[model samples]
Target: MVAPKYSRVVLKLSGEALAGSLGYGIDPDVVNTIARQIKEVAESGVELAIVVGGGNIWRGVAGSAKGMDRATADYMGMLATVMNSLALHDALQKHDVDTRTMTAIEMREVAEPYIRRRAIRHMEKGRVVILAGGTGNPYFSTDTTAALRAAEIEAQVILMAKRVDGVYDCDPLTNPQAKKFKVLSYIEMISRGLGVMDSTAASLCMDNKIPLIVFDLNQEGNIKRATLGEKIGTYIGGELNGEGDH
Candidate 1:
């Protein structure tokens, strides 16, 4: 029998990834594909949790830039994340994956309130947990939510599913000559301004000493490969994994 590399993990996703080519809103086909991949990992006895962003439906940063009330705009963004969570939850259920959607903000009609212990309880019972609502507060990104939840749950690693294959020195989309890093230290990520994640989220993960794997979800089986430790993506860790002060 094949074994997973990490017993437990937090899968972080951006809403744009679910948008597909339409460039907005939930794409059921994409959602289903990701759900199937998540189901596969869960069925393998590797506990899983997810943190989703809402850049596709709404972007708090964009709104704030447009002069909207930052707090109000952020709250709206959180609601968008809830929508994405519910969509993914439905897709996972269609795949027959026992899943729970937990939100940092209260939304009893759709999801359970985020409870650290209860969330762990659900994962222990072989259910995939989806965390949404972006820390239940403004001024925090979903990346921070992933880091905070991973630390609270003591997850072994964070699987950051992105459109890009891995972390690079420059944006690969614009810089054809960009260099991709196979691995990096947290300090390096911070100094390089890699933009893999926001500074706050990266700092939280660094402080907690949690490792993160950034990989492309477009490639089939990458999720499974990442969970099974196939060495498919760029791995980021603290000083222990590379040279840098934590």
Candidate 2:
């Protein structure tokens, strides 16, 4: 098998993806499948860092606020991410892959706090780092967390594993006429408001010149295909090629 083109990459997995078809909470079988895909890519000699969202457990901004404060709601959302990270860590371990869960919040009982140098060192030693707790602050989405972690760890690409196959001009589910973009530039995505990711996260990747690959993780081996430089989805970056951005 050919090695992945990028030496290091960060994977952004939504909590809903972990839920599989049922679409509610963490499904062990689904998580194990994802872990296996990640393991396969890791075996290809690519360093991996994962940033998982908390939407399956909680969406602070979307949920009814009631008496909950905005900051508190966001903190609850961050905790939800920690739960997802721990689940992923366990699943990776089941695949015999070394993994570590680091949180932005200091939760020593469950995992280590986020430390940039330590995260880089873990990746250097071939351990997949699962980053949780959303930048240790409120008002930042996990998408932003992925971008921040990718920049901090010097990852070459951000593999955004979504339910959809790739970036569409409109929500493909609702708009039958929506067109799928094979390739996109950061400026194009921003100007068009394509919703590939939040503007903040997209701008960060653009500034750092980190390519983003939006692909459907539901397809078996898609993650591995992505790491191996296969043209499987929408590629957003400064350059365009059949194998995706280099």
Candidate 3:
């Protein structure tokens, strides 16, 4: 077996990725598939931690834009993330994979509270850790949470799984001629306004010198491919590579 590129990694999944074709709720099939892939990664001797979003259930920014209190709306979004985390935990448990869900908001009945040492201990014990709730605060996106957790846990890279194959200069769905970038620097990503992640998250990753791989989650085994360093998606925060940056 080929050795994986990174011993520890942070897998960032958006809430919409769990929605599948339904586009509103957790799709069991999608969750199961993700669980299976995650199991594969864990079995490969890679320590994996995940940070999930809550857009499928509710988007705090959207709610705030519609007249809800920004903090209240964001808290609701955090709760939605917990729901997604529990659903994922159930699926992984069904697969017989040892998994733990840690929340930032301290819901002891449902899951463990977010503790930096405890989370690292779980990963060290070969258990997958799912980090739910966006930093236990309003105005911080899960993307930022992923960056924060990765830095805390000393992860080598962040696997940013998305619906699209890779980051492009424009909306690929609408523009056939839009160019896909194979690799990008953090400053370039920020200057280009790629929208792959919010500025705060990108800046955090940049400051920490952590690399990110943005790839399509819909494709089976892509996650594992990322772990093995197979060159699947746009690599951000690295030396300049001269391919696919049209």
What TM-score goes with each of the models? 0.97, 0.95, 0.97
lDDT of 1 by residue, 90-114 (tens): 9999999999999999989999999
Model 1 scores worst on lDDT over the 10 consecutive residues at 237-246
Enumerate residue pairs that collide in model 2: none
The 10 consecutive residues of candidate 2 with the worst lDDT sum are 237-246
lDDT of each: 0.92, 0.90, 0.94
Deviating ranges (above 4 Å) for candidate 1: 240-246
Ranking by TM-score: 3, 1, 2
> Sorted on lDDT, highest at the top, how do the candidates line up?
3, 1, 2
- In candidate 1, position 216 carries an lDDT of 97
Expressed as tens digits, the lDDT of each residue in 45-127 for candidate 3 is 99999999999999999999999999999999999999999999999999999999999998899999999999999999999
How much does candidate 1 score in TM-score? 0.97
How many clashes show up per model? 0, 0, 0
Instruction: Quantify how close model 1 is to the true structure by its C-alpha RMSD in Å.
Output: 2.1
- Point to the candidate with the largest lDDT: 3
Candidate 1 collision pairs: none
lDDT of 2 by residue, 1-246 (tens): 686778899999998999888788899999999999999888888989999999999988875367677788899999999999999999999889999999999999999999999999998899998999989998888999999899998998999999999999999999999999988988999999998888999889989888999999989999989888888889999655643443
